[model samples]
Target: MIELDGVSFWYRGRPDPVFADVSLSIGEGELVLFAGRTGAGKSTLLGTVNGLVPHFTGGHLEGAVSVAGQRTDEHPPREFAHLVGVVGQDPLAGFVTDTVEEELAYGMEQLGLAPQVMRRRVEETLDLLGIAELRRRPLRTLSGGQQQRVAIGSVLTTHPKVLVLDEPTSALDPTAAEDVLATLARLVHDLGTTVLMAEHRMERVVPFVDRVVHVPGDGGVVDGAPAAVLRTMPIAPPIVQLGKLAGWDPLPLSVRDARRLAGPLRADLPAPAQPEAHAGAEVLTASGVVVTYGQTVAVRAVDLRLRAGEVLAMMGRNGSGKSSLLWAVQGSGPRRSGRVRVAGVDPKELPAAEARAVVGLVPQTASDLLYLETVGAECAAADAESAADPGRCRALLDRIAPGIAAGKHPRDLSEGQRLALVLAIQLTAAPRVMLLDEPTRGLDYTAKAALSGVLRDLARDGHAIVVATHDVEFVATTADRAIVMAEGEIVTDGPAREVLGSSPAFATQVAKILGEPWTTVAEVAAAVDASAGRVR
Candidate 1:
């Protein structure tokens, strides 16, 4: 239902096009995945479908684009609203109403649908995306994952023939991510909707897609069946990598397939690497922490202690008080009752500036921290705020994520790039205690690896690190300790390997393949190498 013929696009004043000579087509009822690293033009390609590329983004468009028998170059997005429904990566930017129910109705109201019809469609969408409980909640009050599902429901309510989503499951927990993907699959099967999505978490959708379209960041796009395209793709999920390691005839793209081919390899593997135990002096402590919002207790009597050189991961479902606990411990959010000290000083009792020096937090909503127009301006402001040497923030940004255009608006950046910018800005302060909330939401595998390295470096330098996240694989690789929370309380706390390696719901793909305490591809590789050395 969507077709692009020799489409080449470039922004004003840029020499190289983001992508060139990209000819592709998507048939009705097909779910297509756009796979690529961050800032590799995946989002740019999705924009072309709804005429947001040359129309809203102010770019040069070459060749013809047609969607649902409508020419995109000739018609604007509003005219094709019924034919195409587009949801960007950031949901808050597109919201026009205060409450969840109103936001869902706003899109249909714009289409001039009957009030009764809009109400029915709104209810149906609320149930479809699993946001029925959030119908009355304020848009600002919902967690990031809740907002993501709401954003998706807002578009799905329109019930357009074609649905274009950018990282639909990036903010969702694993269960929620699976539900959203299953919802999309149902749309493709029952409603005959054409679904096109861009996602970095390949493992979630690779098994459910009808086809794969890879944008390799070199002005070329490759489209084929999942197995055909994934065999040689540089980036892939752990299941695919395991398939390659075992020399399977066809690369297994899912866990079930990989399991059938993994018996021999798993039998020959060495014992999993044991993680280091950190019992350094306590650098940060939270006692009797109680956070509340009116009648709701967001965090209930939680006590946490962080030692220098320790990497702690706060694990939980969305709205399970992970973010609330992180913010309270950092002395920013509502802490009705708590004693939080960083380096022997009570951060909550200090000035905001001084508190920031003692505890730096990269909030889940990373973009809100950035107000400046461009990356350069944000970097400069961070340096000035921290009283650091000029260009320190900019230098740190490059070290974290190279090739981010300094002149580009922070909002205009990809979700991953924007997160990196905020992280780099926070790190410039060099606080004794560092906290990151959902830092891997938009980062690719390589960017995540780089972040893991950075976090490890900080821990080794005697900085206390705590991360609140839903990404289990990331937790397995980066954190030394894991703490699981539910209903504003900690349910489990232990070594990262023990916590992640034992939980079936939260274990990494590698751990699933080996049925052991393994967590990372590198660890598995080390074990495999050791076994091979013994055999030799």
Candidate 2:
């Protein structure tokens, strides 16, 4: 379905080529995953598939590239539209209509499909994407995940033979991301549509991928079966790590396979530890919180109480009111209907200085808060916001990411590094209640470990921490409690392990395999050792 021979590309004015001598091929009905760090040419490589390389993003392109039996350079973008459907990282940048139904139909209408055909295609796609309820909703009103699903559905309606999605789930919550990936899997299995997607979140998509194209930053690419290529990469999912360590051949990708492999080893697993009882002290509490748009309610009659020395993880699908709930607590969302007490102060009613002093929020888009020239300077400026000591901020940054550049522009740093800067600033203030929204969105394993340590330190120091995130592994490793919300209401609240462990459909496959429900490899190994009468 696609072919690339010795393809090398470089953006204009850049010192080095993002990819050089990269060759790959994807056969019919192949679901290939392209993965790498941010700005490692993941998106640039996908652009080559649908004639966006030399066409839309004008750059030096050398090599023979063919798609759907036609040479890519010879065909215009419109010509390849029927052969390739491209969905970008940002869904709002691609939207053309006001409502979900219209957005899905717009592409088909442009393709000269009959009105009846377009309507049928739109309805089918909406249902296929599990977004039928959003058909009548405004595009702007939908959450990031919902907008992304709509973006894919719009492209899918064109009846393209191949689909290209670049970081489609980057903005989605865990459950919503799973739904989108599941939908893609069904398309590949049932409709025979070939898929080529580039994403940073490999854990959710690795199981379904037939092949993986490992893009190296130094202008090289490794293409092979996922099991073979992933073994040689700098990063691999937890299940793959377990497979490598346990000496399993052809490392299992799915949770069921991992479970089968590790089930017999269950007796060697340690028993679940009993949670320490809470003293019923409220560190952060909210009541009658309400956020609404023109007429639609986003968060309605919400109430929550978080205790000191506790890590609370909020989980839900997109548009399930997770972020809105945190925003209300942070005193930044729409008109409020009730009281939000953080560290015994009503944030919504308190003055700006007093409110921020009580509750510090690390926003989802960390970049929006960063304006300084360097990582060190950014942290220093934030530390200066409340006359926070310089040594404290430096220590926090060093603890989170050692040997990080203090001179390079914050804009030039990786997504994970920028997030660390934001976190470091939040820690300097030492608020009694810390609010982190999607804190682990772009973290690597090492950075995630560093973040876990920081959050754990805060919790141990008796600071109430409420983290709204989709990173299940982070929640498993750090959070003490789990809060599930849906349709503007809290659905469940309980201990983290008890709540997440119950979900056979959603918990980490590696945990299921180890029979320990441990979120990190270190914990898994610890459990195995404990079973062998060893102590850490």
Candidate 3:
């Protein structure tokens, strides 16, 4: 369904091609997965299929690219809308309508689909994507995850032969991610719809794919059987690592496969190490926190307290008030009634500079914090604002994610790289309390590990940290405590292991495979080593 021959593309700029001498073919009814580190041109490749690369994006394209027997270069993106359905990373940016129902039907209307056909397809897509309940909700008011569902539904209603999704599940909860992937699987198997997906979270999509297209950092591509490719990939999911450690003949990609081999390993391994509780004096406190917009209450009365060295994770569905509470605590977002004290002062009452010194927040849209023309300029501005050394912000950015070009525009950076840049800027303030909302949205495993290390070190330095995220793996690795919120109320709060282990929706792959409370591969690996020592 998709073919590229000697295809190479590079933006009109100073240097280098994004892809050079690349050739690939994806057959009809096949589910292909594109895997690579962040900013490795994965999205650029996906764009080429629908002619968004050189056509809409203003890049130079060489060689032939075709989808459904139509040359992409010969046709505009709209010309192939009936054949190719593309959903990008930021669903909100692509929205043209205010309500979910209208957004879904808008594409069909453009195609001049008959009203009866459009109505039936809209209903089918809404049901297919499990977004029926959200039909009448305004697009602007929906959470990130809900917006993603609506984006996918908008394209699926057209019954396009090809579907290209970029990180479709990044904003979704685990359950929602699974449901969407399962629906895609059915489309590939039952409807013969060709699907191509690019995702950083390999564990979720790798198992279900028929082919894996591995894109190494050198602007190249390699394709092979999923097992063969994943085995050699430097970055892999936890289960793959577990299989490597245990010397399993074939590495397991899914929890079920790993669980089959986990029987003996689970019994032989010792108890996993537990993080020590934080007993330091509270560095941040929020009492009776309530946030409302118009008639809608985003957050109800909720109380929260954080110790200096605590790593607290706020977990909940999208729009569960996690972001509201974090923003309120940071003394920036609207709060109807609440008292927040950080470092012995209410940040809300302090001057802007003083409040920033007391608390730091890296919001969901990390790019909002960046306004300079280039990375170097942004770093210089951060240093100037914090009154730190000229190179301090640059140094921090290097530590977070190395090798970012200082001359490149912040807007040009990949989602993950932009996030790292913003995070570095926020860290320069050296606030006593820090809050990050959905920081892992675009990060790969390697970047996430680096972020976890950074956050863990900050916690050790007695910085109170609160992270509101859907990345359970990140929470399991970084957070010492977990707080579950629902409709603005704290439902469960306890040790990270206990909270993540008991809930099926929030448990990590290790916890699921072991059928126990362990939350990470490190914990399991440590237990196995201890068991080996005892046996010896």
Candidate 4:
């Protein structure tokens, strides 16, 4: 369905080609996942498939590229829309209508489909994407995941044979991302639609893919089966590492495959390490915290408390008030009621700057703070208020991102490295309380581990950390406690394992699946191992 032959593209005024001598092909009814570290030309390659690279991006291109046997260079975006559908990273940026039904039908209307046909297609897409309940909802009112599903429905209405997505799940929590991916998988398996997608999170996509295409950082093409190509890459998922250590040929790409190959090895493997709990004092407390944005109650009479040296994870579906609660605690949200104290000082009366002085926030888009000319300067500037040691700043920066040069401009670095730089800067403050909003988003497994190490170190040093996120795997691995919220209210709050085990929607997918009263993969794994004499 798609082909690229010796394709090379360079943006105007850019010194070098963003992609060079690239060659790849995607057949009809095949699912291809285009993956690499950010800015490795994954998105740019997808753009070329739909004629965006040479036309929309104002770039010089050489060689031939075609989709559905139509030459991309000869076709405008509008003409190719019938053959290819591209869903971008930011769905909100592409929204052109107010309601979900209208958004889904807009493309069909633009194509001049009959009214009956448009209506039928809209209904089918809404149902196909599991967004029927959201048909009448305003686009702005929908959560990030719902909005993305709507965006996909908008494209699918055209019934294009090939679908291309650029990190559709990057902005979504685990459950939401899974929903979207599940829909796409259904389209590929049941409907026989061709799928090509680029994603930074390999753990989610590795199992679903038949093959992997790696875009080289220095501008080239790397492609092979998911197993063969993943081994040659410097970055890989944990299951991939486990497969390597166990000496499995054509190393398993998913946890299930790894587990199957791990039968004998599991018996000899060391017991999972337990994180030492800090017997420390409370550092923050919120009683009856109610925050409302106009009529929308984001945190409805919620109560929470943080203790020193504890890693607390706040989880829920997208727009379930996770970020809102974090903002309330940070003193940066809309009007907040009830008592909120950081280190026993009420935050409502305290200036945001003062509250932040005691609690540092590692925001979701921390990379936006990177405007400095060089990496070293950005880290030092973030700590301008305190007489922070230069050596300490360098040490922290190197710890999270030893791959990047400190002398290079932050903008010149890849997206993941830029985020790591911001995280390193946030740690320099040494705040007693740290608030992180989806810190693992857009990060690869290696980077995720690096950031986790930093957070673990801080927690060991007596910093109370609260992470508002939808990454359940991350919570299972890192958090000491878990808080569940739904419809802007706390649904469950307790030990991390208990809360996760009790979540029906989330429990089945856990690495260590369990029934009621068991809330974590570790617990289920332990139970199974003990029964099988696999516990070491």
Name the best candidate (by TM-score).
3
Show where candidate 3 strays beyond 4 Å.
533-536
lDDT (0 to 1) per candidate: 0.88, 0.80, 0.88, 0.76
Off by over 4 Å in 1: 380-392
Q: After superposition, how far is residue 336 of candidate 2 from its true place, in Å?
A: 3.8
Sorted by TM-score, highest first, which candidate order results?
A: 3, 1, 2, 4
Q: Candidate 1 vs candidate 3: which has greater TM-score?
A: 3
Clashes of each: 0, 0, 0, 3
TM-score for predicted model 3 compared with the true structure: 0.97
For every model shown, what is its TM-score relative to the native structure?
A: 0.96, 0.87, 0.97, 0.85
lDDT value for candidate 1? Answer: 0.88
**Candidate 2: C-alpha lDDT:** 0.80
Off by over 4 Å in 4: 11-16, 254-259, 269-273, 365-380, 385-418, 421-425, 497-510, 513-536
Scanning candidate 2 in windows of ten residues, the lowest lDDT window is 514-523
Q: Write the per-residue lDDT of candidate 2 for residues 1-536, one digit (tens) a residue.
A: 78999999977656679899888878888899987654467777888888888798787888978887898889877788888999976677799889999999888887899998898888888877789988999998888678889999999999888999987776677666777888888889888899999876688899889999988667998888898898888877788877776677778887788777776556656765566855647888888888888777888899899888888998877788887888788887774587887767777778877777888898766677888788778777867886887667878877776556677677655556677778888888888889988776556555677889988888888888988877777788888899888888898889887777777644765566664456556566666667667643
lDDT score of residue 263 within candidate 3: 87
